[model samples]
Target: MMRLWSIKRVLLAALMLALVQSAGAAKPAAAETLTIGLIPELNVFKQMERFRPLGAYLSRETGVEIRFTILSRYGNLVESFQRDGMDGAFFGSFTGALAIEQLGVVPLARPVNLDGESTYHGVIYARKDSGIRDFADMRDKKFAFVEKATTAGYVYPLAYLRENGVESLDNHFAEYFFAGSHDATIYAVLDGKADLGASKNSVFDWVRAADPRVDAEIEVLALSGNVPSNGLCVRPDLDPGIRERLKQVLLRLHESAEGRKVLERFNALRFIETSVADYAPVYAWAERAGIDLKHYDYENR
Candidate 1:
C-alpha cells in the first residue's frame, strides 16, 4: 500500500508540471512598441522632457509602448521619418500638411493651449533700433529663418516678401540662414545677430514672457494668418485598432484626472480632433509663396 501511494504521488507531480508548461505556452505576448518623432519646434531638450510624461501616460493608457525621438534639425522630415523607422510623428503644421499630401498620414488630434487657443500665427520681427519698419526696409538686412519646411518660419516670410514686390531671397537680403529653431530665430534678432527674423507667435509669446528684453527691444513687422498648431499624425499603414486607440485616448483626455495632469504639463487646455480641412490655410500660404507641396523640396537647399 505504501509503494502504491508513492507511485500515485509521482504521477501527480508529472501531471502538474505538464499543466504549467501548457499554460505558459498559451500566455499572450506583451503589446507592440511604437516609435514616434517630435518635429523640431522648441528647444530640443525641453521639448523632449515635456513630452516624456505624456508618452508614458499614453503608453499606460493604451497598453502599448510609446517612444519619442527628438529631431535636432528641421530637415527632410518624411525621408528621415522613414529612414529612422519611426511609426509616426507629431508633425508641425507645415510638415503635417506635407505628410498628408505625400504619405497619406492621418491627422489624429491637436492641442488647445492653456490660453484656449488652438492655432498660432507667424510674426516677422526686428530689433527695436534696427530700423526695419516695413518690407522695403528689409532690403540689404540680414534675415533669420527657422527653416524652409516651416509655415511660420518660411512660408509666411516668403509670401509676405513676394507680395511686397520682393521675388526672391537670393538678391533681396544681404545675408540669410536657417536658424534651426524658432527660439533661436527670436534670439538671433534680439541679440543683434539678424536685422529681421520670423517665428510662430506662440513661441514668441512664450519667449517674451520669460525675457524682459523681448518686449523692450523687439518690434513686430507682420503677423501671418492663423494656422493650426502642431498635431499628431500616424502612418497610413498603421494598425487600424492602434490608430483609433490613440485618437480616442487623446480626444478624451480632458475627462480623466490622469489625463488632465498630462495636459497641464503641456500647458494645454485639451485636445481636439483634426480634419483635412484644417490644412487648407497652410496650402494657401504655400501657394502664395509659390511652392507646390506635392513637388517642393526643402530637404537639401
Candidate 2:
C-alpha cells in the first residue's frame, strides 16, 4: 500500500513537470513592453500619429512592445511623471534638464532634422501687418507665450526681452497668457488672437510649410541662440540591455527603407546620441530669464 502511494506521488510530480515544459515551449520568453511619454511639442494628436510608426518599428525590431503617452502640458512633468508610472519620456530641452537633475534619467537620443539641423532656436514673431518689427515696438501689445517651462517658448524669449530693457511683461504687454503649446502660441499671433508670440523655430517652419498665410501675414522678430533639440531620456534604473537596445535601434534607423519612411514623417534625417551635458544651454537661458530650476521643481500630490 505504501509503494502504491509513492507511485501515485511520483506520477503527479512528473505530470507537473510536463505541464511546465509545455508552457515553456509555447512561449520561449515572455513578451515585454515599454511606455514612453511624449511632451506636447506639437499638437497632441499630430504628435501621436507622427510617432506611431516609430513605436511600431521599435517594437518589431526589439521584441518589446512600445507605447506612448502624450502629456497635455509641460508644467506638471515632475509630479505627472511619477504619477503616470511611465518608463521614460521624450523631453523638451528645459524639461529634459529638469528631469536629469531631479529624476536622474539618462539621455539616450535626439533627432537631427531633415534640414541637417539638430538644435532649435526660440523665435519671437508677430503679424507683419501689426507694424511691430523690434522689441521696443512690442510695448503694450498683447503677447502669447508657450508654457513657462519651455525654452524657445518662454524662457529664452523672456530673457531676451528683459535683456533688451523691458522691466515687466504685464507692464509692457496689454496682457500675456500661456498658450499651452508652441504651435498654439504661433497661431495665436498669426490668427490675430495675440499681437506677438514665441515658439520654437522648428514648429514655426512646420506651420509655415503647411500654410501660406504664415509667411504672408507673420514675421519672425527675434531668435534665441541654438539650444539642444528634444531628446529621449529614460529612468536610470531601467534595464541596461533594453536601454542599450533602444539607443542602438534609434541610431540605426536611417539604415533601412522602412526606417527612412519613419524619419521622413518626423522631418528628421537621423537620430544622434545625447547626454545630460547637452542641457547646459538651457541653464544659461534660465539664468538670463531669472528663473531657477528649483523654483520649478514639482511635488507629488
Q: All candidates' TM-scores? A: 0.89, 0.88
Minimum summed lDDT over a 10-residue window in model 2 is located at 292-301
Clashing pairs in 2: none
How far residue 16's Cα lies from its native spot in candidate 2, in Å, is 16
Candidate 2, residues 164-229, lDDT tens digits: the string is 898788788888888888889888887899989999999999999998989899988888998889
Candidate 1 wrongly placed segments (more than 4 Å)? 1-27
Candidate-wise lDDT, in order: 0.89, 0.87
Off by over 4 Å in 2: 1-29, 297-301
lDDT of 1 by residue, 1-301 (tens): 9999999999999999999999988999868999988877888887987798889989998888999988876655666777787888988899889888888889899999867889999999998898878877889999999998999999899999988888779799999989889999999998889989999998898899999999999999899999999999988889999999998999999899988999988868889999889999999999999998888787625
